[model samples]
Target chain A: MTTKAKRSRLDLRNGRIDLSHGAGGCATDQLVKGIFHRAFDNDWLRAGNDQSAFAVPAGCMVMTTDSYVVSPLFFPGGNIGSLAVHGTINDIAMAGACPLYLSAGFIIEEGFPLADLNRIADAMGAASRAAGVPIITGDTKVVERGKADGVFISTSGIGMIRAGLDLRSDAARPGDAVIISGSIGDHGVAVMSKRENLDFDTDIISDCAALHGLVAAMVEVAGSSIRLMRDPTRGGLAATLNEIANASNVGLRIDEETIPIKPEVAAACELLGLDPLNVANEGKLVVLVAPEFANALLAVMRAHPLGAQAALIGHAEDDDHCFVQMATSFGGSRIVDWLWGEQLPRIC
Target chain B: MTTKAKRSRLDLRNGRIDLSHGAGGCATDQLVKGIFHRAFDNDWLRAGNDQSAFAVPAGCMVMTTDSYVVSPLFFPGGNIGSLAVHGTINDIAMAGACPLYLSAGFIIEEGFPLADLNRIADAMGAASRAAGVPIITGDTKVVERGKADGVFISTSGIGMIRAGLDLRSDAARPGDAVIISGSIGDHGVAVMSKRENLDFDTDIISDCAALHGLVAAMVEVAGSSIRLMRDPTRGGLAATLNEIANASNVGLRIDEETIPIKPEVAAACELLGLDPLNVANEGKLVVLVAPEFANALLAVMRAHPLGAQAALIGHAEDDDHCFVQMATSFGGSRIVDWLWGEQLPRIC
Candidate 1:
């Protein structure tokens, strides 16, 4: 039988995990053949070895790792599986690297639905396919009930940096322009909305996406003009901007009007008393571009699907201590401070 | 001030994190200085940027990521801080790679004791120092109480592989021998013994030393003989060998009496009804070597500090399906199964 056929032999829909499945014998074979190998199909995984061996591209390499612990297992728009894949890929891409391979670690809470896990595995497979990355090696452990949440996945990625690309946060300088791709707060709000007992909502979905493509496009255009790039994930826009400013030893002056925020997100923020600027965005990035190349860079960012809503929001200024200030919508000025308090815990 | 002094400027021991710390402002600066920066002291960290930039070496890179969540914050031999560093470093080393840089992410529970946090940070710093790897970049977040364990450390390591080294799990061939570095069940037993309740006593301390140094030595002496390497962590020796057998499309025949075990570990296993082979190990590895080089490899391993107790326990045999059979101390053969249930959860 073909590999796919063998992988599909198991009754995934109604499957239940038995002790033998985790044992290192025929049962383990059946599990991998019937499930994981099916979803995460590739030459490396099919090597059928405890460790994967493959050729590495020459020159500099970028390696990154991230762990996902979003609760409820299943969520709107995506699951833990896809999130794990995207999170690691984004980390690598943020370094101006082309993601190559991923290693996955699973901490499965006992009694989780086998079907849900299969679904998650399948989702991961789909994400890997889309990202052109593979889940090469993985470790799995099952935790007893009450000891762990449903499931926690940690994914580590390795990517190769293209020659001539020198991206680093310290590269940002005075007069560098600050840019953000798309509206912020979508991911945080979506997860918050799904969280139990938070009974408030607007029409919002997570902007969780694999962003290497967008980054690649930007790299192709901006190249050296792009000083640094960071995904505003847990700490949101304000924190990300502040981070760049501090790294470059420059002050930031952002025009609030130029910052992109979806109307629904703005309203939801108002109701929840959370600033859209401080809300976490899984799919957004804070980019520093030399002022001379801001126009060309903005145009290129706006050209990509992931960057359709990109905007040039701010510029760097000479300052001994990095400071972030914004022109308030009411013709006033305010410090765009980092997230204050536990604004929304576990929002990611 | 140099990066070290700047990092040490904050009050890590007495400081309580507030909203301003998470904010991208002065308070955040203090937090970074007093806590993370000091804990991970290095020139790359002193660059004081959102990311660390460095030159990559001229070889294939092996990268690994791990998240640490050991309850009780601290432990006998090492805390989660050290564990996080050792775990990923050992993982990369298993592939015969030289660890270079690491990225760390911390999720701290709100209201956790500052003193305790500092202790963990110091431990992390010390461990990184001992390993000769730097914590180049890191992130910290304060989650609301009950939203997370007191602390969770996510670490990722990047290492450079030597030019001629081509180690992989699939490289194990029929007639190859398997060897394990030291006794089984030390790490797992140490952790469980520290769990709340089930109060137990023994001189058993965690075998939590970093294995990169030993890996370097082993690879230097017997680079070609080695076919595969794995630190049988969670699922222990039985599961790891089984995985290698399956991955290599071979079967394993291990001499039970030949496997090394501490008398204390054996007694504990007998009393707890646990199979020592199934119990997890942290500071250990199962090495696959060609039969011709097995003795020489053993000599090299024994010459190292971490390998003096290393033992030649098994050999690979041709098999389409992987089977791990043990020659019992009683002069009979029995199947060594993969551990189905987690006898010890979160033992890492």
Candidate 2:
């Protein structure tokens, strides 16, 4: 059967998409079975129904969704396909849950190359398999030429929160410690390099990755002591800390010297006149843990590959104004304000 | 509080969306609170977390997703907003489940009017409220102008199916009755009319609606008798029937005269040189039920407002070829094959 399909496969290397791909006809079925199904093959998807029905254990469920409109569909170290999967999985993980299933929806341009679509599906499938999460159900729609970019992917993920784990942004206490999993601004700089056609001597790869495993490892050590976990994707660390401060009604104090950034990424940010503090990092996490368990949580995080450069950057304190202040390396303190406007667009 | 927000409200009437609306900063927060949150206010959404966590009843869970890229975002009787809500809800209902929640992901083009965004969100909120389902969690991303058409919505829905209720397209037996909820071709025609700027003397409205209520009513009367159910949305009745026939390995015989289609919709299909059976109907459903309970199910469906035109248009039978034959009103028999090409693009 595999050989038969391959023999009459789509002209992936040269074929252009047509309206029939989204017409809900035999052509649509061929696209689904020939490409999508072959890549994300799973029992739930093979059920072949309008919806996938399955049993869930009795517990609290967490659901999150993200849309990826990152330009230059193919980027350094990652593409829109992998970013869609990783972004949603990270959202589910932020709640201290075990990410389980994902549903993908794609909007493709009418004349998009079939090869590009196949490559994307393959990448998504690989990411899902690596994370042990399945792409159980999906949808695809095609718009006329120029109506859409090359492709945009929207992924929604559901996960199960284990018993006795309570992680919320508002749970942060004044004495809690703020820890960062790894370096920042890698994802933003990497995508910018490709979109702007800038050449960096050092390879700047996107830090996009699934973080549930790291979250699970940390939970094993500091289950309830952890107050909050956030992946600072869009607004970066500065915005994330500000949000936490407001949500918990506490002030955050950070040391600029303690924050870590790849030298290559820093140079790129400097060249682009962008602030690393406000740049996105797809694979990193910001955690707020009780002061007593901060070291243990950091140790657990560092043990994971995705969190090799973990660092304790700040702590929460009581403040009526809920401000986030950072002690600069130049011996001055500055308020880390919420991002006021767009700094970078389509960086994912 | 409302007055305060309104006093400093976004210039919905004239303001254009900027990349800042999706930058995960104060601007993004304002857009969310002013437009999205205000419209989709609910306890779960109010929590303001990356994901929404909620307890679920123990049962089989059904999940479905769809991406809506319909052109002319606004059309007669419905718009992309309501269509997004109705489309996903119907997908879940087709699996014989009561939709519990929805997660929405939106990709908006920069420079789009804030008024249009608010209107779309308002329509979604209204549709969700009317369907008794909450938009529990969501995400928003913005692309540069020309990177997206205007606004694309991806909705993923989760629903709960009671124990012992099994609905599968492949479960259709040879002796099942084929039933349709209401008039076909309305949605496709309505959207086409708007896209082509062609107005009909008679108002033709898209039949875009949430059909979970109708499904629940029918389930109440004929739970065990239902073999399968589907919404003839994109490829219309022809594609749906063909899919069922192939899936269940059975043959279908339909009487074209029994298939209900609005007069205006039929005339529009003829004017556009399209087949009514191949046009979409957002609010309609195609069900295969045991022949014995067909009348009871039709009675229940007709009692609902969305299914006032319910009719039993066909039946299933054994055939090695798994073909779908239609008896035309002109005393001729023809094969109702799967849609070969695009009938109407971006009709939802």
Candidate 3:
């Protein structure tokens, strides 16, 4: 049966997406069975129903969604496909949950190369399998030739949160400690370097990876003492800290000398007049924990590969204004307010 | 507190979407709070977290996703917003599941009108509320002008399936009965008339609605005796019936005089050289059930508002070729093959 079906397979080398693929006909069936079914092979997909039905344990479940429209589709360390999977997984991990299943939706432009689409789907499948999660169900649509870019992917994920776990953005206290996992601005700088056509001597790659393992380790060590966790993806650390300060109604004081930043990323930021604080990082996390468990959490984070360069750079304090201030290496203090306007667009 | 926040609200009257709205900064916060929060108000969204977590009973769960790229955004009866909500809810309902929540991802073009965005969100919220399903978590991104049409929305839904029901596409026997909930082709003809600027004397509104209520009634009457259910959306009834015949390895025989269609819709399809069976529908279903229970299910369906025009249009038979033949009003029989290629683009 498999050999018989393979005789009329899609033309992967020279084929391009067209309106017929989205028409819900024989052509649509061929596109789905030929490309998506082969790439994301699993039991649920083989069922071939309008929706996937499966058993789940009775517990608290977490759901998160994100859309990846990152330009240049391909980047230094990862493309949009792998980045989409990693981003959604990290969102689930921020809630101290065990990631379970995912659903994907793709909007492709007509005339887009089938080879590129195949590459993206294969990369996405690899990332999902590596994280122990499966893409159970998905959807695909084709727009006109110029109405969309190459492709835009939207992924939604669900996870299971164990008993007696409570994480909230407004749970931070005045005496909590602030820690960051690994360096900042690596993802933003790598994509920018390619988009701007800059000839930089030093090599920089995106810090795009799934952080569930690191998060699980941290939760194992300090589940009760942890206040909250957030991945600074879009507005970087500065915007995230500001949001936490306002949500928790506490002041944050940081020492700039202790923060971790890659030398190459810092150099690129300096040359482009971009601040490292407002740049994005896909694989890093900002943690707020009780002062007593700060060291234990940092030790556990450092033991993981994704958080090898974890650092404790700040602490919470009581203040009515809920301001976030940084003590510079030059013995001066300044407020790190939320970013005013667009510094980078489509930097996901 | 509400008044203070409203002072810095977005200008929805004459303002246009900009890159800053997707920058994950103060502007992004304003856009989210001012528009989305006001439209889709719920406790889960008010949590202000990256993900939504809640408890569920131990059971089988169903998941489905679809992306809407319908052109003209608005049509006679419904727009893309309402259609998106109805489409996803119906997908879950086909599995005899009760939909719990939905997550949305929107990619808007820069320079699009903010008023239009607000209208779409409000329509989507109303449709969701009407269906008893809430939009819990959502993400928004803005692309450069001309990179996309006005906006594209992707929605994913999760539902809980009852333990005793097992519906599938390949479960149909040789002598099952086929039923359609209501008339077809109204949706496609309505959208086509608007796009082509044809001034039809009679009104032809799209039959765009949520069919969960009708499905629930049918399941209550005949849960275990049902074989499968499908919604004829993109390629309409012909394509969907062809798929079922191929999956179940049976032949289908239908009477053309029994299938209901609005007169204006039939006239429009005839003028446009389109087959009514090939036109899309948003609020209809095709059901295959045990022959003994078909009359009971039809009686229950006719009691509901959405299925007032219900009819038993056809039956399944044993055939090696798995062909779908329709007995025409002219005393002739013809094969209804799968649609060969694109009929109407972006009709979803």
For every candidate, how close is chain A to the native chain A in TM-score? 0.91, 0.97, 0.96
lDDT for each residue of candidate 1 in B1-348, tens digit (9 for 90 to 100): 212232334455676654444433445566667777878888766766544556664557665666666655666688888888888788888888888888776656566677777888888899999999988876565545554566677787777777798887778898998999898888777776667444455577788888888888888888877898998876789878877876678889999999999888787777777788877777888899989888888888899999899999989998775778899999999877655444555666
- Residue-level lDDT of model 3, residues A273-299, one tens digit each, is 898999989999999999999999999
State which candidate has the highest lDDT.
Answer: 2
Note the residue pairs that clash in candidate 1: A48-B247, A338-B23, A338-B24, A341-B19
- TM-score between candidate 2 and the true structure: 0.97
Q: Which window of 10 residues has the lowest lDDT sum in candidate 3 chain B? A: B1-10
Docking class of 1: acceptable
Residue by residue across A184-245, what tens digits does model 1's lDDT show? 88887777777753555445778889999999999998887788889987668887887787
Candidate 1 local lDDT, residue B13: 61
lDDT of the structure predicted as candidate 1: 0.75
Poorly placed runs, candidate 1 (over 4 Å): A1-37, A48-53, A71-76, A196-202, B1-33, B48-51, B70-73, B141-144, B196-202, B318-321
TM (B chain), model 3:
0.96
Provide the TM-score for each candidate, comma-separated.
0.87, 0.97, 0.97
Encode model 2's per-residue lDDT on A1-348: one tens digit a residue.
111232334677898788888888777788888888889999777777778988898889999999998888999888899999999999999999999899999899999999999999999999999999999999989998888899999999999998899787799999999999999999999999998999999999999999999999999999999998999999899889988999999999999999999999999999999999999989999999999999989898889998899999999999978989999999999888777768888878
Model 1 chain B scores worst on lDDT over the 10 consecutive residues at B1-10
Select the stronger candidate by TM-score from 1 and 3: 3
Per-model CA lDDT versus the true structure? 0.75, 0.90, 0.89
